[model samples]
Target chain A: MGEHETPADEPPTDEARAEAPVQHGCPVTDSRGQTVLHPTREQYVDVVKALADEGYGMCVDLVGVDYLLHPNRPVADGVTPERFEVVVNLLDIYNRRRIRLRVQVPEHDAVLPTLFDVHPGTEAMEREVFDMFGLSFDAHPDLTRILMPEDWDGHPLRKDYEVGAIPVQFKGAPS
Target chain B: MTVSDPLVRPGYVATGEGGQEMRPRSEVTSAELLREVGAVLRLSEADAAALADSDPDVVGEIDPDLDDQTMIINMGPQHPSTHGVLRLMLELQGETVLRCKPIIGYLHTGMEKTGETLTYMQGGTNVTRMDYASPLNNELVFSMATEKLLGIDGDIPERAQWMRMLLSEMNRMSSHLLFMATNGMDLGAVSMMIYGWREREEVLRFFQKVTGLRMNHNFVRPGGLAADLPPGWRDDVLRILEMLPPRLEEYDTLMTGQPIWRERLQGVGVITPAEALALGATGPILRSTGVEWDLRRGEPYLHYEDVEFDIVVGSYGDAFDRYAIRLAEIRESMRIVHQILDKMPSGDYRIQDKKITPPPRARIDESMEALIHHFKIFTEGFKVPEGEVYVAIESPRGEIGCYLASDGSAVPYRMHIRAPSFVNVQCLPHMMRGGLVADAVAVISSIDPVLGEVDR
Candidate 1:
């Protein structure tokens, strides 16, 4: 089956309707016919939960991107772009449909509620975002570093962070 | 007689408060060592009392509920069975594991951060190193994502698509062969190691002939392949396909029907479907749960829909089920490869679009505009339009996805590798919980996580 399957038969939840300002309850198409949802940070978990109930049970991937340098990033009409964006890809296995959710978290207050309670598989992914982008997840069980050392000084993935270089050493070549 | 014995000299030895021997230093290389030892020995009564009274902070806070009798053991940042530098801290109650925590980052190279500095053309080189075992999958996902962002996906030539599927299936075979070798070694079937590598060497020789490297082949690129397949590539693939079936049957005789192998793997490391979904396990781990979700068949990218093969599934999610699925998948991959060889298309290996790929070498020498286009494409890479895309493929490990965001620049704004091994490793704790410590190696090998991807 192709990705252009009919939407789930379940009625839209009230929480999903409330997210109309950020994203219409109807799914929007991207290049590949993936339904892209731009939910506000407040409605992030609610939208994910609502979709999970509708058989988009598998969380394919959760990714965090720093749009620090990309100020002109496109967004829905009513929503403002943020410094950091968390992108989630969910799949409905039985239906063979893919959905993409993009949520914006501002620079000053870069916090989004945890999706771990809904998708327990997101535990490590959430920790990775906290490690790389310094974005916190509220009510996350353990928000420690996953990819970097625990004592690592700064978020390495931020646009402002320098990509520092360590000089290569050769024996008896130089001090 | 004991006190006066010449062998037990008085000043040569000291006894601890608990009557343990404190041997005197015999060969002091430097005065500094001698002085430190003398100072330690000559501590005055007050100084010694002060030393005894001091309490060290090294014994930090422990979980209050952790029983004092619980034995915490570290498996590896350097153990043979971990496949890499993966370290697992296990809290054990006798022989049974109570809790397991995987502490990674020992192999972290920060490839994602480094990807931002490289241009879009150079992105494949960085991602191919993430999942080194199945490098083409990484390259394919990154290239597809880049193509999607550039809106040039439709322009890719047909020959290149078939070539990609062919090479990827070969890569899948090689990766699974490595798994078979390592899994056997981990499970104490030492002879299977030799047999597995013998078969894998045949496959790698073909890879070396095609890509000029055994592993980390950055051959798959944004628009298409690095170059067209070498002469007689089809015959080479057909020969391998003809030889693999009997070798796979040899494995059946060697391990599949063996009662000991079944006893070690069956009913061990059971991950329920609910737990598997909750933990986001994919690839064989999810397939073993009877999900029937193979991205190649389900998502249908890279002309996989044109091929005919079954999505191998297992009745029970256990180590044996995972093993059976992988073995079955090798057969399925062989079937796909056979079809690809027959239906191989004859056309340009890469897209003819000047914006995405440079003009041919023959055209470059003949025409000035072609030369200039080549120079521009190589020196200043083509800029991708402002957008984001997440493209995934059924890698040997799992759904290896690449999330790329471009900002109308030659270099990507952000690149995130949704590494399958990274997510799959999280389920290790759940699998190992309450299982015997001896079975941990079996479970870890069954997951077959490549540390390059896990700690990327």
Candidate 2:
């Protein structure tokens, strides 16, 4: 749905209709309170749009998380489902403030919508996430290994990723 | 004539176990050192250094000698330009650096990804090790982001804020002192290396006194400090305040007035304001280019709005300007430090919010809930109500920012750092593009990159 159209039948929030994204819901309190969690995919989109309207035009970085051993979402419950989360770090040089969008997605077939259409900086950070955590950004411009070589298997940074297993070498580390 | 003829006729000495030469050795220029090294390594004869104009590591388009064309010179992984194990491929003709490509990640530690597994409080411990030199700045910025996310930024105590400001300026001074020391070494001022490091050691002593650790002091938490300043922190800091200025003046006289230092720095590694901005430069590099945009001034967090200090700027934006601006900043930082010490207010140092800061250690033994709270906080860590926030502070190098994502859990959802050295590094090639290859060292020194920040 276009920004203004709002799904044709649903009424938009009061501030959305006002167009003053900067004054975003004075002391911006949602029914969700201070900590907006689990963001139910649609809530994620609304938050991003509202923030964009608030002047954070740049999504500076994005990284994924694996809650393989989270105490709250303990793995004793058989493979922590929906334990994966993505953090989108946004910056607005114009406004001089920043925000972090924590969007959660499940571990199995973990994927999230790519905001590459809006920010270019996400390109590098997302590819890095894909390389390390195997989480996919649906439409990232160019998803490929950045720091690691093409033949290298397993992201070195992942919690489950093995280290010292791959005796590393560089431009020319001879056997 | 044979190249060994010069070696035979004069007091030309070879390096050895001849009792490791005393440093601040009024040795030859690094170029001359490299030429001698090339001879020692048997890679080239002594005359080959004089005959050759470009780095031997490159060939064809990579070498200027191949076509009388632009040559690519690899400046690091060993060269002095990169402060640590960083490499830059420079395209050069004669002494002019044409196209410089900085190849980093030689020291990548995976700190950000490592941070994901750590709890919110432990996260500061992990991130603080990145810059190594300015540990408080890293922790302070990261803690601020968590505070904003948890909606408790204002709950931090007044004394904690002032202490953070105090230690932060001290960190800035020592960090800039290191820069001065190293920049002088890069410029062939032998004594400056000694002078700068000597001053830095004293600052480290102060850091150890207050935070209990020399480099990685996870002392600045979101709501307050890691621990209150140690007893006598006041007296020790006062001593440092007394010691630094005269030494700085000593450096000013020893090398700042020397024609060789001026010649090496004045017109070298010139970064214009437009290019610095285009590349997202920060700290000394950006200020040298005349931006006058410091987060301390622009946003003014931690009662900075109340403090009176000047944002030092330089006119030329070259290696000299980068040096002079930082030197001036150190003096200004000292001024701020003195003010923080004199004006500090007495109160509880940590935040009162029970959810963030645990009850007193004494109370932990008496109250079961307090004991459990302290244990849980120290062991598993606290939750941050699923949300995200970014907090940036002006580090010695530039803008050191932390973007934190919390999922109302024990550990962070994701943490990404916007390191100043990483951004400031982009302008290296631009600054070096039209400069002589010889001046490349001057430019690199001016940027004062710490690969710990870059590779992290």
Candidate 3:
């Protein structure tokens, strides 16, 4: 969405919307002077592996973001915005450079290939995204919850998940 | 949940659904071990294949003659040495740990979900509690992210930047002090605990005088600080700085040079640089592996570029190296603090922007407009430009980061903190492997994980 896109403003025309995003070989954008690459779910691991070979050895962080409310959020040309995004930050210590990869995962099919093969450090973080967002990884060994109980009903960090909808339960309280 | 259910097993969860289980070494085929163990250990295919070939004690298939000597044991959810409610399930063969898994979330309270409800102006209070030991760093990272989004990151006054750096370095010293106490206590140096707390308390006293709270001082805010430094804050800081060198020397005498301390930690819980990087361990754990990576030096944020300091590293990535690195870092932090004192600039502590900064108390009392502005700023809060940014800084633990997305509203669209301990805790299993069960406490203490940050 545009920075000044108020609810009162007229909806963007198809022609204007088409021309907004600049074309790139692989839809790249910048946020606050940092490089951001928008990769599809399929290209996620390959991009990370290639980056790893190029000295981005450490996978600093991997997080899941739900874009349910901001469905119309902006993206680079040739990139489609999905309901969910897996944001991975990779660091090249030798070169002192950092690159961010944003992989779009559709809500209907929210599975992405695990990055465990490339970066084993992402084990807990991948489990965390799975626990919080209900997004599964294709072959994540131990894809269970990391920060939630085994019997958790739904992903808590989802936009639609109500915060206090369920009654609080004590271990030995009267039902 | 009934007792008869197979899912319920005292403290152990059955393997298959991402749970870790240790099978007999004889039963684990080379291919199976390469696929399973190799992944967990981040071992290369060549290395895994080599490991499989080297173990020629028995056939690849399960040997009926070989007994399954390994038994799984739970270390903590309540063990005093865990630092907090961290639970570790260790698969032990005799006393050697074959496989280990860390089960966390005993302290989870969904603080990220809570961050969405609070406006950006009030978000500092929520993040400060994540790493309670280094609350200023938490607040500093969050504020930096928010300021980046607000596009006033460059406009921050020189004095404010210096002040933030001062508080951050001081927080590092205090957190390391706390670690010294816990590491000593965990290793049976009970007297070191008293000495550690004694020194840390003095640092906390300085924090209390400046921020009005010992731990979670939401004092560092988005625009600048919540308030300026209290009068005579320099004298208070100097007193603590002067008092620390001698105490640190006393610690060196008591623990660093002691044969018992060296024997307990020297070769215990060793991790190579490859493993540390692959496992995502940072801060002292990464540095202890002899990898020269420090955010302040490698990627300078705030006025770290202007300051002079050395990145301390270790030759052998052992528990002793970790302890020694942190001990040396305390002295380095003091050096930085002294430099900050010398170069502390004079200017407004916060930005003078009317949109973000609240009016002064005297102005609010005398003018109706000022009062109304204050009310609006506090109640409604200012809208941030629609964008997303991730800001990371070197906390005492590792890289504490804040990822914020705004939809041009007072309340953030999404807020996430990439906590260091959360990632660093993953190293436990790899580090504990092949070590004696007794050394487990040493490994845990060396990590010095603050559960509040780990589970947050």
Which runs of model 3 end up more than 4 angstroms from their true locations? A1-25, A169-175, B1-33, B40-67
Off by over 4 Å in 1: A1-32, A166-175, B1-66
Residue range A97-136, candidate 3, lDDT tens digits: 8878888999999999999889989888999999999999
Best of the candidates, TM-score: 3
Which candidate number would show the highest lDDT if scored against the true structure?
3
Over A31-95, each residue of candidate 2 has an lDDT whose tens digit, in order, gives: 12222223444455565656666566545446576655552541111222366767665555555
Tens-digit per-residue lDDT, B138-158, candidate 1: 899999999889888888899
Give the interface RMSD values of the models in order.
13.8, 12.8, 2.3
Instruction: Evaluate residue A141 in candidate 3 and report its C-alpha lDDT on the 0 to 100 scale.
Output: 65
Model 3 chain A lowest lDDT segment of ten: A1-10
Summed backbone clashes in each candidate are: 0, 4, 2
Residues B43-129 of candidate 2 have per-residue lDDT tens digits of: 335445543654433322122243335444456677664688877766566777545556656687778777878888788889898
* Better by DockQ, candidate 3 or 1: 3
Error of model 3, residue B280, in angstroms: 1.6
Binned by DockQ into CAPRI classes (incorrect, acceptable, medium, high), candidate 1 is acceptable
Candidate 2: which stretches are off by over 4 Å?
A1-146, A149-151, A156-175, B1-68, B364-371
